[model samples]
Target chain A: MRRLILLLPLVLFLGVAVFLYRGLFMDPSELPSALIDKPFPAFSLPAVEGDRTLTQRDIIGQPALVNVWATWCVACRVEHPVLNKLAEAGVRIYGVNYKDDNASARKWLAEFHDPYQLNIEDARGSLGLDLGVYGAPETFLIDKDGIIRHKFVGVIDERVWREKLAPLYQALVDEVTP
Target chain B: MKRFAAALLLGLAALGVAHAAIDTFEFASEADRQRYRTLVEELRCPKCQNQNIADSDAPIAMDLRAQVYAKLEEGQSDAQIIDYLVSRYGDFVLYKPPVTARTLLLWYGPGALLLGGFVLLGVIVLRRRRARGEVDVGLSQDEQDRLASLLNPTPSDKKD
Candidate 1:
């Protein structure tokens, strides 16, 4: 019993150490959003340059990728080509221009080739807050019923889009299309 | 004259600090303003480095502050507002985390460790006391003398 008591701390410390070691390999940025499986938060914002507005209506009733981005976000610029490819592949992608200068955002899209079907100008980032966007270049996968399925923080490159997002998007499409 | 220069510099520095402060919003009532204050201080800014929304200058924090005010105006309770944020941002947004199965260890581990330390200390102290009581249970001087005499039984004493 005395030996067991003395070994208790070593056992507990080893357990904690194992967990910490495992955590070191995990991505700190991949924080799971609470919005997953929950209805997409309601937001209303003006179109980038159009007189029309984008609201919850644009989000619900379809499987779509809402990419929260800004002209100042380098990762968004990095992911621009992949997003363009996704657009060509018939993926419905909407851009939420979060907390950016409108003119700069427009210029970025023009220079990089616009990939978004419609850009929602969240100049004040009110919509981004509703969507729980921590920073630019966060992508949200919304299901057909307007429920947010997944959120990917950081750049959505070919690898991330293929491995992480595409399979989930495919599942949503299969369920909704049929 | 030097004192005047110092005062002017101090005033200028104070002005700069004031100018650097974030915009303060007004609420409908004192209660609303108080709630807003409490909410922002309790909510964590996800992008900032260990900063609450009230202290962080991050754009996300600004948006969260606006949302808090808007929700207050919409007649939401403080809990509802916080819950709304938690629903969107996960428990990471909360300063006071809820008691959930996942966080039970984080909340109770300290208490368990303290208790264990106390138990161990008590065991060591108790064992030390027992050891002290058992040792130098040496013979008294009278007892020692009596023992010595009995062991070396003099010739006169050996006759009996």
Candidate 2:
């Protein structure tokens, strides 16, 4: 009886530990993709730069990055510098301007310094929902053959650039050279 | 003034009709009604913030309740509607997730830990018993005899 009483506390501790582990980490939403290894969703919109329209067909013949952002999304601002660096390295970037007015998008681009080769306005958020986007500031990497190779939700960081985008970019260059 | 009076009467009649509509949906059977209540209490209203359809005033919750009732009217079981909702919304919509291979550890972890503790307690208890059993106290035959006499209290021993 005395020993049982002593071990009760240890049993309770282990039981609680196992419970916390299951609760905290196990319930993230199932990552679903209709676009994985498939061609990018088709879209054409007025460019953030020139009067010409930018379409999905223009990006398909080469490896590219599609960044979804709005002027109101704070995380998009945080990720802008990393994108600018990617642009400086001559990475092809296309912007999917999400649910914002043309005036605001133009101002945000001017303020943050536009890194996109072509910007496509998705004003109604219909395109975003079709792409399974829950929130703003997501980046998708497409391979040279127009296949969506990767999806990064939320802000892009230097570590993500090094770990994720760099390897895929390198592989695309290798494929082209070989 | 006459137009205002007519509008007031019409508003009162509309209010009465709305009240009658609420009363018409009042459940008939005590047992069936209790089951319906239980289902709502357990099932989550997907569009509400941690609330069930029974408690939520959200339009989506009302629509969901209509769907549930339609299925019930078709003679579908409570479990069937719950299964349909789960299939559409994923397991996150379930207030109490089922105990499956994925949730095995979550459901039984507490019991397993308690059992493990009892095992440790048993081992400690057995070890203590053996340790206590090993100690021997030396007593001479005379001392034993006197001690036995004191405990037994024979007639002569009782006289003292």
Candidate 3:
């Protein structure tokens, strides 16, 4: 019994250590968001083209999609097609080009099809910081009231669109139309 | 040849002293020196994830240290300096992130687990104790009576 008492803490300590090490590698996004249902952060930046700039106002009065991307980010390349589909489906996408140089971003857009309605050049990443972006290629779904309804990190595939985005889009449209 | 060698030795000695002084000498003001030391400890060496700026031999860490000293000379407080770096770089710049809702699980999870483990152990121990029933450390009533009789017998009983 005395030996068991001595061994108990050591066993618990090892178990906890293992738990922590495993937890470190666990997908952080698996943890639910506290920012859900909150209003979208207000921001403005120069558009990818033309003299007009984009702001939070553009997303207001209509349901909108905000995609935070970077020229240097590899995942952004894969996810562009999904964004294009959303655009074709009449989703208004406001692009946040995070911390990339103008020349590279322009070159990238010229090569890959630009699907954004208005692209915000966040070369300094100030707006991305405000949006709590850890890495690029994250997407946010903003409602007509300017509240951020959902935040999606990583690549958005067709499955994600069918499962997650479609239901939310349908609900919001019904809310507005009805 | 000997004279030339002596002069070369003297030159090398002077250079060594200068280098040593640059590396080791602290400022006259204790506060400045202490602040400088603390800043070096606090600053993360991005290239060397496990090491602080002072401990890292990486070139980028050296450059960051130079920048830190430059800013310190310009009269930025510790908080101001940290905030400036955090703004430029992300939270990765800080060796330790601030404890917030996002990091509460990280900060307190271990402590909670330890407390839970203790409670579990206590329950198990108490259960074992109840199962055993309290051990009678002293003699029972019948044993005590037998012991008393054995210790002090009557005179007639002793003859038998």
CAPRI grade of model 2? incorrect
Of the pair 2 and 3, which is ahead by TM-score? Answer: 3
Model 2, TM vs. native: 0.50
Q: Indicate whether candidate 1 or candidate 3 has the larger lDDT.
A: 1
DockQ each? 0.57, 0.05, 0.06
lDDT of 3 by residue, A48-68 (tens): 677777787876887777899
Tens-digit lDDT track of model 2 for A39-158? 777776776657887677877777888899888889999999999999999898888888778899999888889999878887866466446454668888888877787777768889
Q: Sort by lDDT, best first: what order?
A: 1, 3, 2
lDDT of 3 by residue, B10-128 (tens): 99999876434123534657887778778878776655566777777765466566666766777889888787666534455577788989889878988997999899899999998
TM-scores of the candidates are 0.80, 0.50, 0.55
Ranking of all predicted structures according to TM-score, beginning with the best and ending with the worst? 1, 3, 2
Candidate 1, A82-159: lDDT as tens digits: 999999999999889998998898788878999888899999877777777898799999889988888889999999
**Best by the lDDT measure:** 1
Give the lowest summed-lDDT range of ten residues in model 1 chain B: B18-27
The DockQ score of candidate 1 comes to 0.57
